[model samples]
Target chain A: MKAEFAHYKKEELMRMLTIMQTIRTFEEKAGMMYGLRKIGGFCHLYTGQEAVAAGAISSLDLSKDYVVTAYRDHGHALACGMDPKKAMAELFGKVTGCSHGKGGSMHLFDVEHHFFGGNGIVGAQIPVAAGVAFAQQYQGSDGVTLCFFGDGAFHQGAVHETFNLGKIWDLPIVFIIENNQWGMGTNWKKVSAVDDFSVTAGAYGMKGSSCNGLDVLDVRATIEKAVAEARLGRPSLVEARTYRYKGHSMSDPQKYRTREEIDEYRKRDAIQSFRSRLSEEKILSEEEWSALTQRINTQIEEAVAFAEESPEPALSELYTDIYA
Target chain B: MAEMTYREALNRALDEEMARDDRVFLIGEEVGEYDGAYKVSRGLLSKYGPKRVRDTPISELGFTGLGVGAAIAGLRPVVEWMTHNFALLALDQVVNNAAKLRQMSGGQLSVPIVFRGPNGPAEFLAAQHSQALGSYWMHVPGLKVVAPATPADAYGLLKSAIRNDNPVVMLEAELMYAWKGEVSEQEFLVPIGKARIAREGVDVTLITYSKPIRVVEEAADRLAEKGVQAEVIDLRSLRPLDEETIVNSVRKTGRCVVVDEAWPLASPGATIAHLVDSRCFDVLDAPVELVSGEDVPMPYNHTLELAAQPSVEKVIAAVAKVLYREDV
Candidate 1:
């Protein structure tokens, strides 16, 4: 891990930081758009969990590798190089959106970039992710897939089925659990019997590990190693211990956790900590840091403007894409 | 052309398609070394080897999603459910993910997969094991449902289903597997959403599909003996439903009877009866008659089960009602 971290030059590290900031800014704006009634229908923002997507995606080769995740997907989508305007336009239900506006917030997809989707159903993506890996194995590609889900998805029967399928087939995949502390309003502790995933790893007969998802460096290092092993036909399960700053969705009252707890997690905010760490290491100047922040803010603003100007899908589009 | 049973026709289709395209593969429980639950995939294991002829664990929800994923990733997967009774367990993957992926992804992904298995009643496999669940698949817009009656259709539709870009649910009948028919060795496709008139007549239209098509044909034959010509319309494709053929036949006959081996309420037969009542009402000489499986769970006793399901007598009785024949 030290060797891997040492090899990441200032240029590479800056790019990861840029992606994390872009996701944070993009999702914050999406939240605001939802509030203003510009977006509708079950919007789940990826506000605080940017590092897991950023670091994990940065470690994969998007040209061949694949990614799939649950509904909190704007972060994963942006990190996979999706144009923010297209993602925002999708949320706005515009024709220019990536899914042509039919699939709003929870169903984002870009097969060209190999981002499988924003699957809304909890734990459903696991078997689909395994299948994507099956195709990779069937086609004899060295591609490894990264599948993301929340702590809530652990209770689904589908995930358990996927665990068995993936292990038996020895498909090249990484099952990532983004332990963002809560599944909707319920705490993972109450619903889940086994919090430590090493036990799950043993039960499923797959290699497993955990990482500090708050640190982008750790996320990348852990995922990168797992991916390398996956390419050799050794599948794995990696849990990224993280948090979500926003409520589950804009509609959630979030009475389950305290503001103090959110503030406590915010102290270890992935973006702020990485920004400060880069400055102290003489990798990023304060002027450059503020300039990057200003630039990303402007980008998010433009994305919103794009959504505002984009056309709503025509009446005929409703009939199209229902088949083929 | 060759004489083959329904199961052999299905096996031949799989063998030929897998030979034609490298993307086509068979994956289901007992599809490999165990042959197949119904012997439909008997020799495919030796033909395509383990990579293509895969036997999955009894994880319908898991493997079905995997098949959808594989299809989305540009592989054609023929996933046999052994029996659609077990497919109930995997409905979430089929309804939520496979059927909706293309539309929800806004056409970026196409799930080119086939979920084929025996449906409806057979032997004494009552209640849960013998449901004609094709209506559920047809109820969804994104799916194309194919219910083949003959070996020729079993061969052709299965081949075409493998090539279709959208998801296809093939409703096969357990009792029909041993029914022999002439199938052409030279490949052909019985295009989805088309109906073939099994027996053309002008007196009355008998609309039916899979399993019950045989009984309907027998009823038509008996009607022919009685000097009353009856049209037997075999609806091979259930979803895009051969409405043109159905309406056209009803118009010609001026009377129609729908025979479906499924529960009556909102069933395919009722749907066809409504279509006839709506599309050919002006041309109709009599009210539409529906001969559907009794609105009850399938009973275990053979006699009770026959009473519960569609039979030749029920089809004839419905035909009689449509004809206004009071045994004069």
Candidate 2:
């Protein structure tokens, strides 16, 4: 981790903190709404691992670089520039949603912001990301594709196939694994033979590095290097040892792990850690932190109101975009 | 008109399209130096080099999904799936990704990609290789599924597929690859979702596509000799089926017989029969008859394979059955 991130800046650190704070606020509101039975269906929140999306995307040019992630994708979308209101409205199943309410929490797509989607199938985005990178390369554009998945999806065969292809073709693509300890009810160790996912990249002749996802600065710097390498036509991998604060979805009771285990990760929560670091470095005073918190709370409130006032899509729209 | 084999016409279409637009390129297994599995991409590697006419490893899902991504990212990638059988390996990428990306992205991204390959049963390629999954894709909403019956349609439809701003599945017939036909020398485009009447008549309407189209034509010729005027409609595009044409024909003839090289239950035959019955049943004098392949996997024996697929004899029998009471 030290060697991977030797160059770090304060503004970048502040930016990472801001992203994590926004995600934390948005996720907490979403979880509260889910508990109140206001938001229906599947709801996966990115709580313990805010830095993975925030840090990785910070190194990318949102106007050009493409971002694709697994179902646990709210954080990635927010980090890439999707308004919290539109994202929340989407989760609320409102027509004003990012995908016009067609996709919920599991499938968030905002192409205008260069956020491809929040794919549900395991390791499905690996090849899609490579394709995007291939297009960039074929068209002589210096763009890159950053693909993220979970440790559970890492076991999928398509992941390895894409890794090899991305390396061989030297396509500008990055594979990011958010190893959040558990896959639904099962742990990562039981599902995977080799626990070290970074080693998986060596077979494809690409550099693979590991980072502490709880540390926002470390994640930002590491992903910056990975994106740079990919931009040079050399694909790379970054295994972020993070934790999801909520269950796999709103449905899961999280019976596989102990409350104590959850508490242990919560002690090093990414959002809390960043807040503390910012205060310690005098970047933000306690009074300023409170004001920022108040501002984000207002934003969340307006997003919910905007969604509640929005109308549902008409029945005829069901078959509108079957093709372009 | 210029005479050429279906394979040559298809190759010419790709070469011409790629030369016409820098955004258009070919990628798939054995497409570059290997000259494609069927030599359809032969001599393309030397002209375009490895970057444009890329030869991919045996990773259909990877490359196909990459093609979808490339298309969505703004490049026209014509992906070759060695055969329709191999497409099963990449179903998730094609069905879930390529087909749904545009809608899912709120029309922000368009997968201008073509998943093309020789489809349907071919000789003794066995059960795995000979399965016809064209109807399976036609069942999908966002995908434009096109199966050309003649060399002219093959060339024109391919050019349209390349230029379409959506994902298209170009299912060619393996048996019809070497078949010779006359195609226009000038470039042309056949609009998708439109069906053409290969032979116009008044006794009955025969709906078919791909290899079974030939069988339907033969049956039409036989019926013409017997005073039965049968109109044969070769449905070039399956998904956006020209239902108006089939309904109008069935309404006029007062009878219909659907021919397909697939099994009877819920296949293309069933789809057409149901559509006609639901929309134009009152106009029909007799129940719509369907001539379909036997409900069994294609066998290695040439005779057994012929028996398993819908044949000219079977189509003739069905047409005769439909027109039995029409004439003395």
Which number leads on lDDT? 1
Backbone clashes in model 2, listed as residue pairs: A322-B142
Highest-scoring model, TM-score: 1
What is the per-residue lDDT of model 1 for residues A167-198, given as tens digits with 9 covering 90 to 100?
88899999999999899999988888887854
Candidate 1 C-alpha lDDT tens digits along B1-328: 8899999999988998999999999999999999999899998898899999988999999999999888888799999998998999889889989988888788899999999999999979979998988788989888999999999999999988999998999999889999999998787998999999998899999999999988888887887888989888999999899899998898898999888988988888888889999999999998999988899999899999989988888878877887788661
Q: What local lDDT does model 2 show for residue A125?
A: 86
Model 2 Cα displacement at B270 (Å)? 0.9
Error of 1 at B317 (Å): 1.3
lDDT by residue (B169-207, candidate 2, tens digit) is 999978889889999998898889899999999989999
The TM-score obtained for chain B by all candidates, in the order given, is 0.98, 0.97
Off by over 4 Å in 2: A1-9, B325-328
Model 2 lDDT on a 0 to 1 scale? 0.86
Q: What does candidate 2's lDDT look like per residue over A1-324, in tens digits? A: 233223556566667777888888999999998888768888889988898898889889977899988888899999998998889888887777887777788888888899998887888888998988998898888889999999999988789889989988999988999999888889999989887899878888999999998887788778888888988999999999999878999899888999999999999988887777676666668897788788888998888788778888778778776677
For all the predictions, what are the DockQ values?
0.84, 0.75
